[model samples]
Target chain A: MSDFPLLEREMNGKPLIYLDNAATTQKPLAVLQSMEQYYRTHNANVHRGVYQIAAEATDLYEAARGKAAAFLQAKGAENIVFTRGTTDGINLVAQGYLASRLQPGDRILLTVAEHHSNLVPWQRVAKQRGAVLRFLPLRPDGTLDLDVAAREITPRTKLIAVAHISNVLGTIHPIRALADLAHAAGAAVVVDAAQSVPHMPVDVQALDCDFLAFSGHKAYGPTGIGILYGKKDLLAQTEPVQYGGEMIDSVELYDSTWKPAPWKFEAGTPPIAEAVGLGAALDFLTELGMDTVHERVQDVTRYAYEKLTQLAGVTLYGPGLNQTRGGLISFNVGSVHPHDVATVLDACGVAVRAGHHCTQPLMRWLGVHATVRASFGVYNTRDDVDVLVQGIQRVQEVFLP
Target chain B: MTPNLSDLYRQVILDHSQHPRNFGSLDGAVAVALKNPACGDEVTLFLDVADGVIQRAAFEGHGCSISMASASMLTELILRRPLEEALHLNREFRRLLQTGQADDPDALGDLEVLVGVKQFPARIKCALLSWNALEQAIEGIDGTGGNPP
Candidate 1:
């Protein structure tokens, strides 16, 4: 609790009860100090200078890549590439890997539960490559319909992109099984782990996904730094989307040679300080242990589900208690708009997300304009859920009359 | 509701939200649909124009209380008014929501209740959703509606 200073602050004259973890988590002291230390003592352009500070900066940056590789349990640091965020990472794969491979009339398989970052890039690639995009529908409880997936992942499918955990519904997909299905069909799988990586244990090796992407800020690291993990062989074959400094091996007037894999992928100066902060954040999570963190958040989520279900006219979306769920719950309070509910909750110092959550297609599929989402993090407790329940009661009191 | 929230969702605003005015489509009316990309709230405004005046105005949409109520009051204020005068009120309504001050308070009528929305920087868009639709609808109007005043 003391490590996260922002949680101790006040909103609307009451202690802040932040429940917007799905958007981004508050940074810890360790991450903050690490970024500060990098700026103060190790600030230098990496990989270029002949001086000592530049070498030290290069070491720190590479060490952070090692941390990210270990965090995702990828094969090695060479398999990891630094990106702006999950969107950037997915776009990289779309253009660098799938765009050139896609053939006319080929298929790209996706789920209705994907975030826009995972969905839009594929749409762009499908359009550019003259390929068709197909969607695997969800069951009523928000889980993927495997029967549909089995039927959809035919030989013609060149790529399958999915969210490991639905951002709005919090329904955890069966990634291992999906990966096997895609592999059997000779299609590559891309996992959007933006929501799952921060909440639970994720092993790229165990999942056997061809590619995976996650943002650092969602895991309590600094923003502007993210990870794109790919199989070494696949990354070796994929082209670099961005071209310029550092990524070049040697250059002539009109033609140039390039470096290999991850180095070639990181074209510019890269997010040096942000990567240092992300390394510290992964270290913080590693020290706490991911299983323990998962258990703690699940406890809070179960308590929230129990309390939120008791309220009359409160409709919870996604999975029920018997299903596998994640660290968040999205719901609507009767006919009271989620925006109104969120605003009233803000008056009570309970901050939650209320919008399409960048999943408008899913919103349309769910027959809703938007939903109010109360997500959990490491520092949240059952007491925070109680305040949220109280704030919701206030919303009913104000709007139901 | 807190004092500040009460100011934002006063009784009149609540009434309009519960039962909006001119809330269905009008036959042969010029229509425009607008959505707040941030929140997914959408409103479709329809205008029946004749000569240079707005014969009728209505909306059909779903959104938060601020958006629904603002749409309801927008219909009531713009009915039977000239296109130019209605556009003026739309501008004034937006000014009130953004700055909490209206140059002509009487010109805004029931829309003035949304003045409290200025305090909620995040929700000003909800209050302005329907007016923005109205602006777009007026733009599509042919010469039957004269130039903006």
Candidate 2:
């Protein structure tokens, strides 16, 4: 699968071994070409122009919405609202949906392993609405403690926001079960599927989540485009947080009416080229099959996990190789700092993420300041893992010896 | 295709990182903690200044070799120097790193070894963490008139 043109290029003279897919995936030629085609042929403002080119632009943009809806297995295009990214999507729910529904004593439940994007928004909303922010604890191995989740999610919980996959730990959370429990308590379930959607099969209906959010860039699509999937009824009830030209139905000097659902949320001219790119990305994944893509990554991750564990002085985080995990592994070598480890790896043309992964609380919980994460994508191969293993050994030789 | 490791992680830098000098808190000293939030590198610098002179300097933290070695070097170089000279050296060292110059060997002494860090832009922050902490501590002293409490 080295068909990706970027993989053929050299970094620091060596072929680049990109193991930072959790940060963002490398776009395929199809995704890039589709985006280029949109700008070169159908370059026009969507939904506003009556001309032929504008009509084609509008059709392509709306068709992207349809593709996104089908990709997530949502009800229809009405359920999919475009946002900047996962952060924007969550902020929409926090401000537009939950802001009014939240009461003074209501609880917003989240797990300890959530990325800052998922955690900080709730903190702001909770503070705004006088709602209490609570956490569902994790087990020793970094998996969520469902028993604690069962007890903590009480009737007072207004919303249960959690990551479908822990970005730092790479452990997949039990979203469907959590959604069921939250639904039983009359609380809406909002999933930060930023990591999960790109790596696995995510059917909103199957998970039974009230709302789901994911980014396009992380799924081998372009930035500035993401999807927020909400139940049609819930979206209709929630107020739009933004107001401007495209979202309006009718306007007066002091009074105005609004369009319905998705359009109402997407204010101003949307990211037309970016939405087209995401549609092409989804199409590419569909052709390859998500299951095949998932299995490919899992194979690479398992190989990396096994290799890293065998090396002395390497402490691996998250679940064991035998357990279920997303396509990543966070680790540290001896007393070598993660930044230094990453630097040494970069010298050998291996790019890994070495930071808190935006999960500082989880870092504190893990008793580490930071970790070096090697995340796999569909294009990764066993040879990439071998190079990563060798690079890590070089780090050990440099720092330890 | 491997990068030249010796240029970045020199023997002296590695040795200083492994056996850091004055790696402890100074009692009754002005202290300030600095953190590189992106990488989680942290250093708490404590300076015992007496009548415009740095009587002692020490630090304690967990970070990479560049940061730890830079902190160790900072403590070693600032001891017994007047507060003004210490502050000046901090600025001079930063300028050297930013400009990638090593001309002032007589003044910079052993600190000149850090000139190699100029090539690696990302590692420059690691090499400057302790100096930042020292600058903050000095500013704290200036603001409080040496009575850090």
Candidate 3:
């Protein structure tokens, strides 16, 4: 069945082989239709509309939250709070939850390979709170050295934030084990699920993480919406960073009383349509089965990895082909710059991301300025990999010829 | 494949990128580094100016073929030209790339190869990196009375 209508389109008179899914997934028709239907039928402000349309809008928005909660296997809908994206979600936890609890001697432990979104907030929080920001070094294979992590995380570590999957390395982190380690050290664990949530099954309960953050657009949903799932007791104790209309129970001139966990976190009119579209995205993934999607992605990634390895002058990063990894590969070809590689690939109608991938620390760690990354989504096939391999060959010919 | 590849990565641009001219630091030169934060394309331009004329121009950095080649060609074109003329050349080259029209062909000789960059809006910044650095370097030097310590 033709699930992806976008794949049918052509670029430069060639079929579009979109391999930049790690940046953002192309939305399926279901997501588009869901958002369209919401705008067409239930177009109203959420939470406070006494009118029927407003109530429907509120219902759809909340229903999306519930679906997101179920998707992450959280305790209930109240555990889910909507934000702009993964960056916003992490900022909420960093500013609202961790900042108040951290002391001068406390440490915020994170991996060296975290996206700038995950790393910068903690840097700011640490600077403000006098907390020490510590990094868990990566192994030679680009996977997290959990042994080093276990050694670094101590009683003084109040919060441990790490990406569930490296956006650059494509190595899936051992979140459950890391969470267990953090909890034993009296540290609350926060999972940056922006890369993991879309490609695999991420059960919050199974992982036992205190907080998890993900963006909807990365998982085939609309932009400008994401979810932050925190534990009920933790969120209840944590104060909201943003204070405005619709989030307070009672507002006095000098003092104010706020609503419960999720609502208190959501200030102002949230992304109602985007949430509805994310709900539809969850439904689409659920029907297709996350396991099926994960397996398909693994196959495509493996194919691309193997194909890239065989090519001369190509240096691949991250885990081995046999090892479990996310559906992407970051690599460099000879001395050709990634921007030039991506431009040549674009000429051949292949879309890829070429830059630091927002992991500048990791880029420095990797000893390269930048690398070309070809990532996969569910719509990708072996044929796409074949085309990408051919495109890389073309890049080599142009640059290395 | 269509000829768009050749249109973008012309052989001359490739030659310059592969073996960039004046591709090192100059001794006792006033240097300024410019970076395209979006793509991590960085260029550190070094200029040896004496008596309002560019004595030597060189750069050292890593970027795409377009950017590296543009930097190489920029140094070659601006060398021995007066400071004002070099700044004027920077403006004319930017205009040509932005408008895709060689309004002043005599001013932009080798830089005209970058006219194809106008077709790719995203690549325009890559083409402009060196010129941007040159502009900043000239302004820095001029602001310091054409001689900076």
TM-scores for all candidates: the values are: 0.97, 0.97, 0.98
Candidate 3 A-chain TM? 0.99
Q: Is candidate 1 or candidate 3 better by DockQ?
A: 3
> Can you tell me which runs of candidate 3 are displaced by over 4 Å?
B1-3
Better of 1 and 2 by lDDT: 1
Candidate 3 TM-score to native? 0.98
Candidate 1 backbone collisions, by pair: none
- What is the per-residue lDDT of model 3 for residues A1-401, given as tens digits with 9 covering 90 to 100? 27668888888788899999999999999999999999999999998879999999999999999999999999899999999999999999999999999999799999889999999999999999899999888888988877888899899999999899899899899999999999998999999999999999989999999999999999999999999999999999888999999899999899999999899988898889999999999999999999999999999999999999999999999999767999999999999999989988998999999999999999999999999999999999999999999999999888888
**How far out, in Å, is residue B109 in model 2?**
3.0
TM-score of chain A of 1: 0.99
lDDT by residue (A149-197, candidate 2, tens digit) is: 9899899999999999889888899989998889899999999999888
Error of 1 at A292 (Å): 1.1
RMSD of 2: 1.6
Q: What's the fnat for candidate 2, on a 0 to 1 scale?
A: 0.97
Ranked by DockQ from best down, the candidates are: 2, 3, 1
TM-score of the second chain for every model: 0.92, 0.92, 0.94
Q: Residue A3 in candidate 3 has what lDDT?
A: 69
Instruction: List the candidates ranked by lDDT, beginning with the highest.
Output: 1, 3, 2
lDDT string for model 1 (A1-401, tens) is: 89998888888777899999999999999999999999999999998998999999999999999999999999899999999989999999999999999999999999988899999999999999999999999999999878789998989999999999999999999999999999999999999999989989999999999999999999999999999999999999889999999999999999998999899999989999999999999999999999999999999999999999999999999999998699999999998899999999998999999999999999999999899999999999999999999999999989996
iRMS per model in Å? 3.2, 2.1, 2.6
Error of 2 at A338 (Å): 0.3
